[model samples]
Target: MPHGFPIYPWLCLLFTYIRGLNSTVGESRMKSLLLKPRSCSRVLQGHPWVFAGEVQDLLPGSENGKTVVLRDSRKRILGSGVYNQNSKIIWRRYAWNKVPFSMQFIRKSIEKAIQRRPVETCRRLVWSESDLLPGLVVDQYGDALVVQALTLAIDMRLPAIATILQELTNAKAVVFRNDASVRKLEGLETYVGTFNDQVLEPLNLDIDGLSYQLDLLKGQKTGFYLDQREQHALVSTFAKGGAVLDAFCNQGAFALQCAKAGAKSVIGIDSSDTAVQLARYNAKENRLEATFEVENVFDYFTNNRDERFDLIVLDPPPFARSHAQVEGALKGYKEINLRAIKALNPGGILATYTCSQAFSMEVFEDLVSGAASDARRTIQILHHCYQAKDHPILLTMPESAYLHGLILEAD
Candidate 1:
């Protein structure tokens, strides 16, 4: 029997073993590996974002807006996401489950987001990653859909998303205001145009009993700050019988609300002459007693130090673009809040907000507190406000909670 043994059998066994070993090694190499452990911690901690530094080894070089699989060190699959090496957020996780990222996924996400709120005449249809579709936001204004593509990943998928919006909402037109500065971070150019059909004029919106005319083409953030709708209603409750000053007032949202709430007088100030004219027109359309001024908010505060008001709103744009600019932003916040606090009469109300994501809630509160202390005034917290329900914040991503407002009383 030993004599019948052949060398060919031994060679075959060796080849089979080597092949098996090679396959095992190849599979190990195929596992998605995050380069940085800290990045893995963030993802494992339920955050949906992964920075470029977090990846230990991306199997393939970062391709712009290409879907890639995510895996852990143990050779386990984590999820699927889009890769954008140019962005600080290199990976935007779309789903935790094994689902193909497709138009169907986007449509379902949009539908689910829309269902979260009661049927409103106007609302946000898609809130970026909050809806599990990162870098895309769609606001519904009656028959029109205003879209903002803020990232390369979303911009690449804009056509599919836009088609879904038009088909689902039966929108007369879809307008792409791809003018957000964040796009530049993803190496994308700015663009503004109408999709499907031309939006010839501003669209009229009736929101929470008040009517608003929006210039989808020329206006900011899809023609209005729909996220501030609830805050506007809250301010109206305290605006009655007072002289209200709306600084940085665009289109008279706060001013019109105050006037409609029976405020004795309303003064809206903005640096843009066009904005001032539009605000004045809005007040006139609503039959409200409101005045508009084309002056910079900071300049107005500097020139009129002795002016006093019963109620003042300081809703400024985001002062910080990155974490490094937070200190300068804080200084700016302190300056404006200090002036606004000093301008308020005794027992007056100050409705203030910071739309900066870099400015955390604690930092914003400290800034407000410091302003009150500098003005030698006592401040009482009335209420804390956030973006409306239409702009849903994802629990997994705390960064999505960008808007913060505080109603404070000065004594």
Candidate 2:
């Protein structure tokens, strides 16, 4: 080959190297974030999360929990947040206006969250994203508080969080149930322990005259289904002088309430032996005669062809945790609901619920509608119920409205 031809090949290689170098230098100069137009608009509209994919580019040298400036494609500073590259939710936004990521900020946010909630003994103290303390949740069961830190930034600040929580609520004990599966996604290790480094199991919680024993360290979802508090009270309205069935009865919350509401008989069924035992204990502790048995709800419904109830509650755990599980979750929901509809006599009340955010309200309505069709029954929608007041859903964040319920009657 000619010497000039070799020079031409060298020229192409030099050109490509210069372009890559320029691109790297440009990204390195960027301050943590440069969101696409769509992402910037979402932040502008008060949505807190900044997904990892939403970011057009991110600069290095930004540590987790440090204030990172977010900018639009046009390079205008939109807002700032605690950024962590490891999380799918890269930014947990603190404010639209700039704010310091400091102890003072944490204290102010905690104080604001507490003021809105009931200053009573038992309630949700911090509701994660809804209360604007994203990745952090705190619930008060009497004097003890359960804290769950779901993300790396929050998990790293456990000591500070524990100190502030105790100070604000005057909590005698603080238990951390950071053992959720979601923690793995955020690159955090699952942990469970108390601030005082000792868990007081069989913690007594008295709610609306019902005394319940719970193992706070080992119990599900911060030791109880505190979100269902309002539903338990409301379900009792139709339970008076009727036979009631509480399917998927975790700890007998609804079943006990129905018995206390003057139901002739209340039969609660759960597949979990532990839940059944705890529920039976709770029923006895209240001196309420309710039958709780360890039986598969689906099997019981399918086998017991002649049994019918005046009222039935189908409060299942989250049927769909992720988007991919929606199809299977809908099928699961329809199966139980169909069984419930078939077991209900004419004028029977069906208090059905879903805690899956993936299953939208419209979809839940359709699921119930489809169940009614399969059962060949006429149903009337009586009431629309949501999570208790303590777990407030933010307007911008629709996923916070995870719990949806409907009280219906067969005709």
**Which candidate number has the best TM-score?**
2
Candidate 1, 1-411: lDDT as tens digits: 012223463354345334332121222232244545434467877788777767775544435565666766654667767677778887778888545555556678888877777777788888888888888888888888889988765665665667778888898888888778888888777767776446458866777776777888889778889889999889988889998999999888998999999999999998889888888777677777899999989999989988899999998888987889999999999999999999998889999999998877788999999999999999999998889987888887778889988999998
lDDT of 2 by residue, 1-411 (tens): 111223453354345334332121222332457887655446767777788888886545346545666777787766657677877788877666555455667777899999998776678888887876778899898889889988665665656777888898888888888789998878666667777455476677788779999887888788889899999999999999999999999899999999999999999999999999999999999999899988899999978968999999999888799999999999999999999999997899999999999977888999999999999999999988899898998888878899999999999
Stretches of candidate 1 off by over 4 Å are: 1-33, 37-41, 59-62, 197-199
Clash list (residue pairs), candidate 1? 34-56, 35-55, 35-56
Worst 10 residues of 1 by lDDT: 21-30
Candidate 2 pairs with clashing backbones: none
lDDT of 2 at 314: 98
Each candidate structure's TM-score, on Cα atoms with residue i matched to residue i, is 0.89, 0.90
TM-score of 2: 0.90
Against the hidden true structure, what lDDT does model 2 obtain?
0.81
Give the per-residue Cα lDDT of candidate 2 at 320. 92
